[model samples]
Target: MTNQSNNSVKKTVLVTGAAGFIGFHLAKKLLSEGHSVIGLDNINDYYDINLKYARLLELGIEKNEAETYNNLCNSKTHNSFSFIKMNIEDREALPILFKNQDIHIVCNLAAQAGVRYSIENPEAYVDSNVTGFLNILECCRHHNIKHLVYASSSSVYGLNKKIPFSTDDNVDNPISLYAATKKSNELMAHTYSHLFKIPTTGLRFFTVYGPWGRPDMALFLFTDAISKNKPIKVFNNGQMERDFTYVDDIVEGVTRIINKETAERIQSNKFYKIYNIGNNNSVKLLDFIKEIEINMGKEAEKLMLPMQPGDVERTWANVDDLIKDYDYRPNTSIKNGVKNFVQWYNKYYNS
Candidate 1:
């Protein structure tokens, strides 16, 4: 971990998907840095609503109290942070939020985020990731947001045999609808940056896991199954690998970009950039499971299965651009990261 760097001047920042794992952590980080943060999420039931509510609970917003959509709920723990229950695709409401909140920086982290789920529910991906991101770009254009930071995905590098996926590498061959939408987000952001001159940066995140993670993610699902003595379905017959970046490292990279001054990022052509934020260390599935088992003090009963649809064999991120620009490097190893997650899971679930 690096020293906490405060923003030169505190600005009003809006974080979409505030109830989600990454959003919640980023919002918390910004608020702790003394910035006024307005978090927005529809609180969808993609995985577990209770888990979402628990994340909100950590942000000091009572789940029952955040009922009204688009209505702001002040955080009980911090004066600078507030949250709202809303969908980003709401065309009419999104613009109103930008104008009313006086938002300076827009962090678009909300999306229908599951490669496999995108196979079954394609419309959900288009509606949220595509249409919703368009709405965000429109709002940033009209309201003159200083900078727009959005989440991209490592899945965009689908089927690439390259060792380390770079931002400069070709990502046109997306294997899943989820990856396609995220790639579309990068294209959309570039267009907006060129036309409207809205400074935008897209981050392609690798497998992010830690406390308060989504239950649908591999780490959380495997942890839960192992704790309950249930058989965990390991896809690809446990022959997969992922550059599992820790949640705090992702947040650190995001905040560094968000706090960057306008002069620091204005490129010659357009104020648009993309960076991959990953640990740069890929670990195999079996080794990752071993770390989890060691942390939990129980070995998982694994059910080896072939790869499912919309799945990839491996993903590795080349974070050279992120390192060169932001001086950010993911430091948390899988051992410590899994330990932290297991500790949180045990305490949160009283298992």
Candidate 2:
């Protein structure tokens, strides 16, 4: 049975990695759409715990309450939203939460995210992306989850020289551990969808950015360094390109997939699918930096450097499947997107 609100079916969604960039935006979007949300995150110090706590505060969960483990904290602003401070790898506790929450949908966005960082700390990727994802699949297999949507990365395309990477392209040669883990997730999701008959969809997000974005991303890094009169690292000697999709656009695609009727998405006798969620236009790295400089009203000191290990030179996502299936339209241009991020950075850090 499903709850109906505001001419839409209101679902109880369990969104893991609720403190992360895409997760936070997705959670806010879900709440505004009248869905009941149960947010889960360990709030790891991958970048800054303060930023994570700040995002939670926006969702009406206090910092003091967000710090406690395994304790459910209800939202003060939205009665339909609640949060739990926990890791997905907590195999024992995760299942119990699934049993109690009556979650109709599961969106697993919780995973160790950096490509270079995965090379330095490989275990973190295995723990969170592999083992933790296994737990999510187990819960879905046991519990009658209506649909499971999870995050995959464009890095999974690895060293593919193919332009406009598509789901039909071969992804067997992931260069980094992070990419390998995400590819493994696609395989795992496929397995569960085939064996257990669980409907699952995975999104391959390409260079997501915008307000409340991760500090480690290029937009934030460049903005902060330029504002501080410091040099920004220009990788691949400023010869790279990325399909930098805005956060709101990515969230829109996600919400569409979440709310889509399961009966309409089956493919090849299996209820599994994968789509690329991206701007569909790859902008040059230097051009992206130029846009940031334009927004910040300052020039960036570029420290031209060789491409780092485990990093791809360019990423261009082919989002044709997303467009065909969900009417996913990523229309945010790099200019407006960078302007929005710069405005947010100035307000968030200066004020």
The lDDT of each candidate is 0.89, 0.89
- Residue range with the least summed lDDT across 10 consecutive positions in model 1: 68-77
lDDT of 2 by residue, 11-50 (tens): 9999999989999999998998989899999989899999
Q: Give per-residue lDDT, candidate 2, residue 277.
A: 89
lDDT of 1 by residue, 225-244 (tens): 98899999999999999999
Q: Which RMSD values do the candidates have, in order?
A: 1.7, 3.1
Evaluated with TM-score, which candidate comes out highest? 1
Total backbone collisions for each predicted model: 0, 0
**What is the total number of backbone clashes in candidate 2?**
0
Q: Where in model 1 is the C-alpha error above 4 Å?
A: 72-78, 267-269
